[model samples]
Target: MKFFIRTFGCQMNLNESEIMAGLLINDGFEWTENPDEADIIIINSCSVREKAENKMYGAIGGYGKLKEKNKNLIIGIGGCSAEKERDALLDRFKKIDFVFGTRNVIDISNLVKRAMKGERFADFSDKLNEVNYSIPKRPFSKHHAWITIIYGCNKYCTYCIVPYTRGFEKSRPIDDIINEVEEYNKNGFKEITFLGQNVDSYGKDFGDKKPKLDLLIQKSAQFDSIKRIWFMTSYPSDITDSLIDTIAKEKKAAKYIHLPVQSGSNRILKSMNRRYTKEQFIDLVYKIQKEIPEVTISSDIITGFPSETEKDFEETVDLIKKCRFERINIAEYSPREGTVAHKYFEDNVPKHIKNKRLQYIMNLQKKINLEENEKYLGKTLSIIQEGKAGKNNTYMGRTINNKLIIFQSQEKLNGSFLKVKVNKVSPGPLYGEIIEIINNI
Candidate 1:
């Protein structure tokens, strides 16, 4: 059988899709790049934003036309959106043959088998504290992979659908995570990003007396083959001094930190159920910079929320100016179903105003990014050659700070690190020429 999986949403969703693909391969299935050639089509979805859900519906509708040509093709929907409305989605999506939730993803093979036998299978969000087990052995690139450290969230941020759809926080046993990393390292994977809904809150569910994130990072660093360690989606409230200390101290840990400050306005933050204040977020940023000078800070910003006043918007603008984030993912607020923000706040922010606010944020960020890139001029930085950039012979790679660097090179140098001296800078990327090969190890 042939299968094609389309993934949406955050890194966690991507990791789940990888696991699902691995499971399918083990079940005597081949992966097809084209959806039309597949016996099974799975839409791994996301519901964090209404836009994501709309995209899924559109994709499903398009796939429905394909099903018309091949009636035997099995359609499956999994991940956050599927978990949010399982049986209802199955009923609405009559052509969908199988539906599985986030918790039951590892059961893809069993579900496919049952669906093949004419059974309409659906499993939504798992009950709280439930555990599903399967060790999926999926094929991966020899250079990089992702290892999930934890699942779900307890934060219940007002704007997020994760808590309702994915349930509360659950940390994978430390040994399990370490073993996975070891296996990847042994297989020649050079980089691993620890994934979670809220990575900083990892050990809280296990009743560990101390923070487990530090121990997990420290343990992963011990693997000699692991060249770079990175993790994401850190909640400010859960970030600790020890975690910063570890990242600063560990040689293997990537010098890039993505700590999301959803909003800078205290009122908007409280309304969004983000426990920390603007000052606290700034303090954390300062601490990370002080302790880890090479650390590149990235953030997420919501431009307009319900009832956001001019002052509130200005506060967010000021925060951006103050923080000077290395990269900013700016989004206009879109109220999601089952989220606290949707229930309590009116979605009254005018579309034009919200967009203008977003543009303002982006414009400021662009200026900051240009200024930061200027510092790299005449400096030699190590980069892993990702391959030719765009359609030209310009090779593309990234610095350890996760900054994108593009340079012209006649030689093919993919999957190896090169030392490049920056000769020029663009608004979006650094332009450099390779001076020498750094390390083949």
Candidate 2:
């Protein structure tokens, strides 16, 4: 049997797809790059935004058509959207053979086996506390891999569907995570990113015996083969001095933080159920910068929420100006079903206004990015070469701070460390020429 998996949404979803692929491969199924050539197909989905759900629906429609040519092809849906839609997906899309929830990834082999026997199934059972500590993973990237140290979210942000789709926060034991990191290290993986909906909330469920995100990073740093350690999507108030200190003290820890402040307006923040105020968020950013001076900070911003006034938008603009974020992912608010914002608030923000605000923030962030990139001009920086850029002899890589750099190279230097001197800078990426290849750090 041949299988193809299409992944959507965040890093967690991608990692789950990899795990599913590994499981299928171990169960005597061949992996196929083309959907038409596969005996089985799975759509790993996301429901964080309505747009994401729409894309998943469109993909389902397209893939459903493939069944006409091959009636025996088994179609499966997994991840957040599948978890949200459940059996309803099978009812709506008659071509779908099976559906599984976010927590049912480990049972994929069985799901496929059952589907092959002409038995339809929808496994939405709660397996939040179950930990697959040593499941094999076929990572898409050879040099870097995502390791889930924690699962789900408890924040219940008013505008997010994550809490409903992913269930409550459950953390993996530190020793198990470290063992996985060691496996990746032994297999020549250079970078390992610890993933979670709210990485800062890791180990909070364990009461007094809680092992914090800092401790997890500390343990992963013990692997000598791992060149970079990173984590993401931190809750603002949950960030501690210890976590900041760990990033600063650990030589392998990447100097990049993806701390999302959804909005800068106090009213919007409260409406969105974000626990931190604008003042508190600014203080946290400055603190992180003070400790890790070379750190690059990125954020997420919503353009127009329900009843968001011009003053609220201006406040967000002011916050961006003050913080000078190196990168900002700006999105126009789209109310999702089952979220507090959708249930309690009116989606009255005009589409044009929302788009206008989003564009303005995008332009502002591009300017800020250019300013940040300018600081590296004429400076030699270390980069882990990612791969070829397909233009002449150009190769692409990222600095320790997660800034993208495109440099000229004569050799395929993927997974190698090299020093590059930035000759030019753009809002998008740095342009440089390779200086010297470092054999070891």
Candidate 3:
């Protein structure tokens, strides 16, 4: 049998899809790039935003057309959306044969087997399970991979659907994560980004045991082959001095931080169940900047929250100006079903207002990005080559601080590090001239 996995959403979902691919391949199924040619199809869905859900619907219709021609085709939906919308998905996509939640993803082979027997199955258990590290992964990039250090979220951010879909935070054992990174490093996947909805919350679920993110990262640095280590979506309240110290001490840990401040209004933040205030977030950013002079900061911001007034929106704008974030993911507040915001607040903000606010945020951020990046002009930076850009002789890479750099180079530099002297800087990638091939294999 042949299978095709269509994945959407965050790195976690993508990693899950890779795991499924490995599992399916182990069971004697070959992977097909063409969805129409596959005997089985899985849509690893996301429910983070209404936009993501809409895209999934559109994709399902597209795949449904192919299912008509191949009557033997087995279609399945997994990940966040399927975890939340299990049985309901069958009514929506009549062709969908099976539904499994995030936790049961490792048992996907059994689910496929049951579906092949003409039995429809839906599995959404609340119990947390340790992932089988023995499964081989067909990672999209051999040079870099997203490894989940922890699964799910403990923060019940009023607007977030993550806690409901992915359940509470369950951390993978620190040694397990370290061993995984070491194996990947040995296999020549040099860069690893440890993933979690909130990385700072790692090891908190370990009662009476010390939290392990800093320790795990420190140990990961011991592997000489691993070039870069990264973690994501750090809750501002949870970031610690130890983490900052580790980043300073370890050459492998990327000197960048992504701290999400959902809203700048103190009132909106309180309503959103976000622990930090606007002042506190500013202080945190300042603290990080003071500690790590070379660090680049990115953030997540939501505009047009239910309680946001013109004054509130302006405060958010002011915060953006103050922070001057290198980059930001700006989203218009959308009420998610099963979230506290959806239950308690009226969706009083008009669609037009939400969009306008989103535009305002993006416009301000674009200016900030350009201005901040311009400072790197004429400076030398060490970047890990990601891949070659489609543009002639242009190779794309990123600085250790996660700044994108595009430069002219002849040799294939992917999976290697090089020094570049920045000649031109923009809000996007900095154009540069290669000064040296720092390390090439």
Candidate 4:
């Protein structure tokens, strides 16, 4: 059997797709990149934004057409969106052979086998901390991999569906995470991103005796094969001084942080249950920037929430201007069915208004980003060459600050570090020419 998996959303979804692929491969299934050549087509989805949700529907519709072409092809939907609306999906898509939730991915192979035998299969949203089902698998990349340090979220932010869909907090054993990293190092992977719903809250599920994130970074840095370590989706409330200090002090840690500040207005934040004020978030950003000069920060911003007024939207714009984020992910709020906001708050913000607000945010961000990139002109940046940038001769890579740079180079530099002097800067990407070769590891 052949299988193809399309993934969307955050790193967690990507990691889940990796595990699902591993399971199928272990079951003697060959992986295919083309959807048309596969016996099974799986979509790992996200529901954070309405756009993502619509994309999932479009993907399903496309698969539905493929099913018409190949009646025997099994279609499966898994991940956040599937878990959130399992029953509705199963009812709507009779052609869908299987639907498994985020929690019980280990059952995929068996479930698909059952579905192939003319049996219907649907398992969505299981209990938290139920079992640790770790499957050994190959990564899509040779140089980088994601290690999921924790699963699920305890924080029920008003607009988020993750807690209900993925269940509560569950931290994998420290030894398990360490063993996985060691194995990746042994296998010649140079970079690992410690993934979680909230990375800062890693060891809290266990007793305080277990080492926290700072200690984990310290231990991972001790390994010679691992050159870069990073963690993502940090919650503002859990981000501590020690974590910032550790990243600044640790040589191997990436100098980028993706701390999400959902809204800048205190009123909107309270409605969203973000737990931190704009002032506090600004202070935290200041601390990080002051402590680590090379550090670049990214943020998640929601433009229009329920009851968000013009003043509230302006506050968000002002806050973004103040922060001057290196990269900002902007989304117009979409209410999930079971979330706190959906039940209590009316979707008062009109579509046009929401879109206008989102545009305002993006427009401001464009100028800020251009200004930030201009600072890098004529400076040497060490970048890990990723691949060819589109059809152009230029190769693409990211600086240690996680800024994307496209530069002209005759030499092939994939999976290696190169030093490039930035000559041109744009809001989209930095255009440079490779001046020197760095570590080829």
Candidate No. with top TM-score = 2
In candidate 1, what are the lDDT values of residues 1-441, reduced to their tens digit? Answer: 999999999888888888889888987899888999988899999998888999999988988889889988899999899988888887898889888888877778888888888888796635324332346656444566777778888888888899988877788888878888888878777788888888988888776545588888899988887888888878888889989889888888888888899888999999888999999999888888889867889999987789988899999988888888999998899999888888888999999999999998888899999998899889999888776687668788887778888988654467677888899986688988889986655
Question: Which segments of model 1 are wrong by more than 4 Å?
Answer: 125-134, 409-412
Instruction: In model 1, state the lDDT of residue 68.
Output: 89
Error of model 3, residue 271, in angstroms: 0.7
Candidate 4 C-alpha lDDT tens digits along 13-105: 888788779889988999999999889999999987778888999999998788878899999899888888887898998888878898887
lDDT string, candidate 3, 1-441, tens digits? 999999999988998898889888888889999997999999999999999988888888888888779998998898888877879998877888888898878788889999999998787754345474566788888689888888888889999999999988899877778788888888988888988998878898889645568887888888877878999879998898899889888888898999998778999899899998999999988888888868989999888889688888888888888887888998888988989999999888898999999998888888888988888999998888788786788888898898999988865667777899999988788989889887643
Clashing pairs in 3: none
Q: Candidate 4: misplaced stretches above 4 Å?
A: 125-134, 209-211, 409-412
TM-score of each: 0.95, 0.97, 0.96, 0.95
In angstroms, the error of model 3 at 229 is 0.7
Best by lDDT: 2
Judging by lDDT, tell me the better candidate of 3 and 4: 3
What's the residue-level lDDT of 373 in candidate 3?
88
> Lowest lDDT 10-mer window, candidate 2?
125-134
Q: After superposition, how far is residue 393 of candidate 1 from its true place, in Å?
A: 3.5
Candidates by TM-score, descending order? 2, 3, 1, 4
Candidate 1, poorest ten consecutive residues by summed lDDT: 125-134
The clash number for model 4 is: 0
